[model samples]
Structures are given as structure tokens and as C-alpha cells.
Target: MLDSIKEVLITQEALQERVAELGKQISADYKGEEVVLVCVLKGAVMFFADLARSIEGDVTLDFISCSSYGNSTQSSGVVRIMKDLDKPVEGKHVIVVEDIVDTGNTLHYLLENLKSRNAKSVRLVALLNKPDRRTVEVHVDYQGFVVPDYFVVGYGLDYAEQYRNLPYIGILKEEVYQSK
Candidate 1:
């Protein structure tokens, strides 16, 4: 699996350190409020688990699966909700957790949908952000890293659903995606 990677973009240690710090910030920010952590499914599965464990305050968790990239590098430009949150967010401080923000379409759609449901306050927490590729502006309250617009995989990110198990984030070789 290591042989397929062109280079390691972020080490496992670095990811853990950043996540821990994010947890601290979140704990402090929502210290006296009712907090609901919404995990965007699949890609954020790993991040949500780690973040949830690290947070110190009272927090409730829910998950919703959303998709824009259906087995492709770029989004289809239309976001769809494959699964919806089990609980309502009305008058609750909500934090939307995501693995990565690329084009920002999914986040924008999610933000609007959450607002329509009357959430008290909505904030974004993304593990990775590729600002160069953004087509829509997104406000990320807690961003792990600002990355270059390279196709990256691992730490819950994937390519062809094959690289999510990798411990570190790495740049996928071009040939892997271009092969006939």
C-alpha cells in the first residue's frame, strides 16, 4: 500500500496533534451551551470518532451521509443527502464535521439545509481544506490544514475507495488514476 503512494503529505502524528487541539478549542467554545456534533458520513467517520473522544464537555452525536463525488475526483455539482440526521437541530448549537472541503458545494448545501431546520448556531469543522479548488466560499471555523490542490488520500480520505485505511495522508500518483 505504501508503494502506491507518491509521497506522504501529512504524517499520522501530525494529524493526531491537530485533532487534539481542535477538540480543546471545541470544548472551550461550547463550554456552557448545548452542543450537537453532526458528522458528515463516510469520509468523516474517522475524524468524528477521534474528535468526539477528545472533547471534554457534554456533546451529542448524529450522522448524515452526503455526496457530491460519486466515485470521481470532482463533484457532480449537485449535493444529495443519502442519509439524514436522526435528531432535529432546532435551537441547538450545531457543529458540522467534515473530512475535507474541496469545491464547497456540499458544505454550502448542508449549511442552508441546517439553517432551514432552525439550528441555533451552525459552525463548520473540517479536517482539510483545499482553498485553491473552491468554487463557492465556505466559512470553516476549525480547519486542520490548508492544503495544496493535489489529489490526496488516507486518514479517511480515499481514491476509488481504496486508500482510507492508510495511516497517513499522501498524494496519489497520477498514473494510478489515469491507467487504462
Candidate 2:
């Protein structure tokens, strides 16, 4: 799998340091408030776990799975909710944790859906942001890094379910997917 990587964009140490900083910022922002951290499943699992631990306040976790890409690098532009929150988010402060925001289609749909559910407030925290690819407007309250247009995988990001276990985020070689 290492052979298929073109370059490591973010080191493991960098990810850790940034996550810690984000945690501190979040803690301060929501001080004296209990927030629900909603993890956008599959891709943001590792980040969600690490971030939850770094937070220093009352926090509950929930998992939501949405799919726009299935074994493809590009999104089909159709968002599907594979899994919904186990508990109602009504009257709660909800934070959506995502691995990356590219086209913004999925997050836009999700934010609207969550808001309609009567959540007191719904905010977004994206580990990586790629504004160049956005097709819709989505506000990210907290962002860890701004990445260029590259097929990145690792630290919970994946390409066809591979490379999620990599310790750092890396650019996947084009040939690796082209050959598929």
C-alpha cells in the first residue's frame, strides 16, 4: 500500500498536534455546554475517536453514515443516508465531524437535514477542507487543514476501503486507481 502513495501530505505528528488544538478550541467555544459529537461514519472514525478523547467537556457520540462515492474517487452527486442517528437530536447542540469536505454536497444535505430535526444548533468540524472542489456552499465551523485537489487516503480516509489504516494522510498515486 505504501508503494501506491505518491507522497505523504500530513504527517502523523502533525495530525495529532492539530487535533489537540482543535479540541482545545472546541472546548473553549462550548464551555459549560454538553454537545453531541456526530461522527460521519467510515471515513471520520479515527478522527472522531481521537477528537472525542481530546475534548475536555461533556460530550456524547453518535454515528451517521452517508454515501456519495462507492469505490470511486469522484462523487456521483447523489447523497444517501446509509445510517441515521440512534437518538433524536432535537433540542441538542450537534457537531458533525467529517474527515474531509470536497464538493460540499453531502455536508450541505446533512446540515439541512439535521437542522430540520430541531437541533438547537448544528455545526460542522471537518478534518480537511478542499474548497476548490466545492459545488455547494457549506459552512465549516472548525477545520483542521486545507488540502489541495488530490486523492488523499489514510488516518481514516480511504480509497476503495484501502489505505484507511495508514498513520498519515498521503496522496494516492493516480496509476493505482487508473489501473482499476
Q: Residue 31 in candidate 1 has what lDDT? A: 90
Candidate 1's TM-score: 0.97
lDDT of all predictions, in order shown? 0.92, 0.96
Per-residue alpha-carbon lDDT of candidate 1 for residues 1-180, written as tens digits (9 for 90 to 100): 677799999999999999999999999998977789999988888889899888888899999999999888889999999999999999999999999999999999998899899999999999999999999999999999999989999989988788998888899988887772
The local lDDT score (0 to 100) that residue 105 gets in candidate 1 is: 96
lDDT of 2 by residue, 39-110 (tens): 999999999999999999999999999989989888999999999999999999999999999999999999
Clashes of 2: 0
Q: In candidate 1, which residue ranges exceed 4 Å CA deviation? A: none
Model 1 vs truth, CA RMSD = 1.0
Q: Candidate 1 lDDT (Cα, whole model)? A: 0.92
Assess the local accuracy of residue 115 in candidate 1 as a C-alpha lDDT between 0 and 100: 87
lDDT over C-alpha atoms for residue 141 of model 2 = 99
Clashing pairs in 1: none
Best by lDDT: 2
Quote each prediction's TM-score.
0.97, 0.99
